[model samples]
Target: MEPAGRFITFEGIDGAGKSSHIDTLAAAFRRLGETVTVTREPGGTPLAEKIRALLLNDAMDALTESLLVFAGRRDHLRCVIEPALARGEVVLCDRFTDATFAYQGGGRGFDAKVLSILERITQSGIALEPEKMRDPDLTIWFDLPPEMAAARLADARAPDRFESQPAEFFGRVRQGYAERASAAPQRFVRLDAGQPRDAVWSQLTGSLVQRGWLQAGTSDVGASAS
Candidate 1:
């Protein structure tokens, strides 16, 4: 029998280095001869990309913005993520619903009830489809303090609308992430973002290997050991 496709997501606030690490991991997986399909949230498919612009641009109510995000996610899963998973390819996503709980429920002061409603709407349609609604096999949360995340954003181009929120808002976002991870310990793996790049990479590879997602001694080599 073929191995089941894996859906893995890298999650964190803006500037948490998830993008960089995801790139590194994808390359590593390819070097190991693994078939991997990489993508990002808020903008994976065409429709999602347009929705992303609206979410990140200036002047939108928080509720509207959050709902738009879920809408984009629904289209993305239907068009991109679900198909790749059904084909038995590893799916590496830059963000997933965990981000919604963080940025919308925590940062924007929306209730978790709102998230549940949107999730039902977005996921219900595909919940029973072939190879559907398989929650991420692993959600790697690149845990970092709000201050550090803000500092990294500062070094980049002008902060996007979400990145421009007050420091306290981001604090709440972090708390939300913490809450989600706590609730789903089996699916969420927290990585220390305070460490150096190499150190974090080591931990990431190790987690994946321990979860039996990758071989112990492949291109990941020493990376999976540390």
Candidate 2:
């Protein structure tokens, strides 16, 4: 059956295991008989997927890449996310606007003002007001050091452009996420992502219970808090 809640986002850096735990949480939600729509940013919609390739592929310039991300988000919101969210489905996304702030603002040293401008331009046509934009009801930031994250990436597939950046850059991005989370404590739930998988899941579940999102039992963010 279709769900009757809005959205939830899974946030984290490259190797913080956000993807892994998203799977676990989704299954838990299903067991509770809640409908969910699992998706990700930079490519939830068809046009956005192509933009995602351009953004993640190594060839594009940083400015171009960042712009493309906003483009993808614009389309993703209009076509897939907003509709599902309007229907009150639980939208589980892998990443969202926070990634742009972390990667472009912190890692690449881009002015956040630029992002504000892009958001305004891209999202203008959508009927959803600024306050009613498809924001996650809960955001979970899996925290981990960049050094450890880089090591974890080593065993994975070929690195994306962002993943291939210098460790120092990613460290700054991590710091940015922490700062952002602190700035919006009500929306974000910070987690010590360096813990074991089982331990992390335990902490996640506890948060979900605390939030009253999960019925009986379920899974579970940070700034601009989730």
Candidate 3:
């Protein structure tokens, strides 16, 4: 199921500004003449969106929550991500399996081994092709302290189930993200989200340039032209 297109995922604790910059990055890619597919985890297709609603609002046990997310992921892969990537479009997803690991495994104290099993089942199914488990080519992890992230989200909106968790929970989630990045350093770029917005943007753009996703001087011009 791995496709020719690149998959990029954004990760962070809530309110780390991942959402703020996703579209901007996608626009940059489009400027480079890459077809971009913007999507999100626990939701993408119709069924997945409905599942997302439940995952966000409904109270569920940790195992139940993990299973639901994997179900939604399966539908998302089959309906949206795979096809777009097959067509050579860059897929910019808001989050993916990483969130499941962070939220369910790290935050909720669920068993990582159980998550691994479900991950394989949902990603590759019975066919058992390891390569079929689609992983992002690059992950931009916006690193922020849990308290600061909580402060930022204070007045944003009504907290969802995950967002309603305490700062200690978010701390665990942050650690989860950090561990994932450490385990996959080459595929991850960690940015300090606590910086000023402009500085953060600069780092993001710089990372892209370093990765050869953008030409140094042409980004602005190409973006404007597109």
Candidate 4:
């Protein structure tokens, strides 16, 4: 059987505004009396965090990047994600393997076939069964045009390695996300992050309620988050 908890992932190219709504959603889930574990990829655990620093600051080849990412993912699974999951807490993760496939495989033009192998090797055994791979029950993808993304990022902060990439790279990353969504529509929902903040929050909360993860009409943004 699957874990008693649900695993949800948020995805988008940087500056697409996906991160803006994660905490609000987490609060909404908490209001519904669920135990929520909100975390991010490449930095969920100590080792993973160190890897995240290197990934965002240091330059490396695609293959090396892939290996480091998967290495971090393995530790994150064992030390953070899977455990929270096993304890029946909802896991709201910011990015996951899909980002790896997008950033490394598509953005960096790495080998997709090898990514497949790495995905399998890194994600298997989630159910304590070697063949069973872990995946989000729902993936909320914030779809925004690359041009808008660039404009949004322009004054946000000092750019990191991935954030500083050219518009062309973001386009490829967006395409990669689209491909992943296309291949798994049942597990994915596309959100227009370009929408007004309240509208986006409504859609997000509504999605969880529709899936029975949250009670209907419990859509108020918590005091702290609102």
Candidate 5:
């Protein structure tokens, strides 16, 4: 039987350069003869993508937003993430529950306890064990100052509801991510996003190598996977 696959997630506030590097990591896995499945939270399955649209465009209350995201997460897990992992294909997710905690719980002042409960329910099904919930084996958090992240977003595409929030809101979101990384240091690797693109890529690939996910001297064999 094939070995179980690794689930690696990329997370950070909007404009933190996560989207810029997720595919690079995936291509590295592919070059190593690993089947890579690149996907994202709030969307993966068709139904979940619809939910993603609603979540990004609508201005709903915090609880409502949380519920909607969890609902999408359920569909994503059942339809995409679980099956890919079962097949021993490396799953590279752009974002996951961490974003929900950062945005809704931290930025919107929603209750973390409540989010935790929902997390367990959505990822673990009927089980109440927090440990049973699906979590990334490794989460690459692109840590950047909120101001710099905002500046990056300024030149990017039109802002979504969350992206349109004030700088103070992003500050709280960054704090939320910091808390998560502190709480689960083993699963998270925080990288400075302010560095040059090549430096950021080095940090990412180096972390994967250190964790035994990649070989010591594998060269980039394909074009940019961005």
Candidate 6:
């Protein structure tokens, strides 16, 4: 079936201020009569959420961590993501394989080759032909300095495993995300997270509207986009 839905993902390190914008974007799409399914990685499905708990709190080797999240990803795909797309609903995922690559491969210094192989095996087909690997149509990356990100999280809720990583590790993860964005420039939009909150939202919403996913006036914020 031709998937009519759009798959967009919001990504960034902890405290890049990505979490606050997703639902608001979903609402904008809904205003345009689009059905938007907002979900998150390593935790979209029940089983995936179980895996998320382990990955977040437990200490394990990087390889083990990668395997668990991929397993969760597979389930999340089959159970939640794919179905929503099949029904023509926009999927707004908080994170996906990129996060795994960032946290495990980049942060933990795991083998990227292994992550690539796992990604191929696990995500070969979902909303597309069986031979094609599915990817988000658009990825909005809030690029923030690791130091500033750490500062944002200072008094926030307690961090999970990845969130608690040192500045050096986050620096690596940021680079990892940069590498991914570089590899797929068309699919990625990098936002300077240091900008004022209004500016960040302007960029984020403008991205969607600019892509023609939403009408010109789609974003009350991105109306500035026109």
Query: What TM-scores do the predictions have?
Result: 0.91, 0.89, 0.92, 0.95, 0.93, 0.95
Candidate 5 lDDT score relative to the true structure = 0.87
Cα RMSDs, all models: 3.1, 5.0, 2.8, 1.5, 2.6, 2.5
Which sections of candidate 1 miss by over 4 Å? 1-3, 127-132, 217-226
Clashes of each: 0, 14, 0, 0, 0, 0
Q: In model 6, how large is the Cα lDDT of residue 82?
A: 84
lDDT (Cα, 0-100) at 78 in candidate 4: 90
CA lDDT, candidate 1, residue 144: 92
Query: All candidates' lDDT scores?
Result: 0.83, 0.78, 0.86, 0.88, 0.87, 0.87
Q: How do the residues 145-225 of candidate 1 rate in per-residue lDDT, one tens digit apiece?
A: 989988888878988888888779889999999999999999999999878877788788888889776666543443543
Q: Tens digits of per-residue lDDT for model 5 on 1-226? A: 3229898999999889988787777777887899999999879899999999999998789999999999999989888888888888999999999999999999999999999999888998422234577888999999999999999999889999989999999999999999999999999999999987777887888888898889876434222333
Model 6 has an lDDT value of 0.87
Misplaced by over 4 Å in model 3 are 125-131, 218-226
Stretches of candidate 5 exceeding 4 Å from the true structure = 1-3, 125-131, 219-226
Question: Which candidate number maximizes lDDT?
Answer: 4
**Model 2: CA > 4 A from native:** 1-4, 121-127, 130-132, 215-226
**Model 6: residues with Cα > 4 Å off, grouped in runs:** 221-226
Ranking by TM-score: 4, 6, 5, 3, 1, 2
Question: What does candidate 4's lDDT look like per residue over 1-226, in tens digits?
Answer: 5678889999999998888888888887787788999999988999999999999999899999999999999999999888888889999999999999899988999999999999999999865688989888899998888899999999888999999999999999999999999999999998888887777777777887888887776556722355
Q: For model 5, what is the alpha-carbon lDDT of residue 18?
A: 86
Cα displacement (angstroms), candidate 1, residue 56, comes to 0.5
| CA shift of 59, model 4, Å | 0.8
10 residues in a row with least lDDT, candidate 1: 217-226
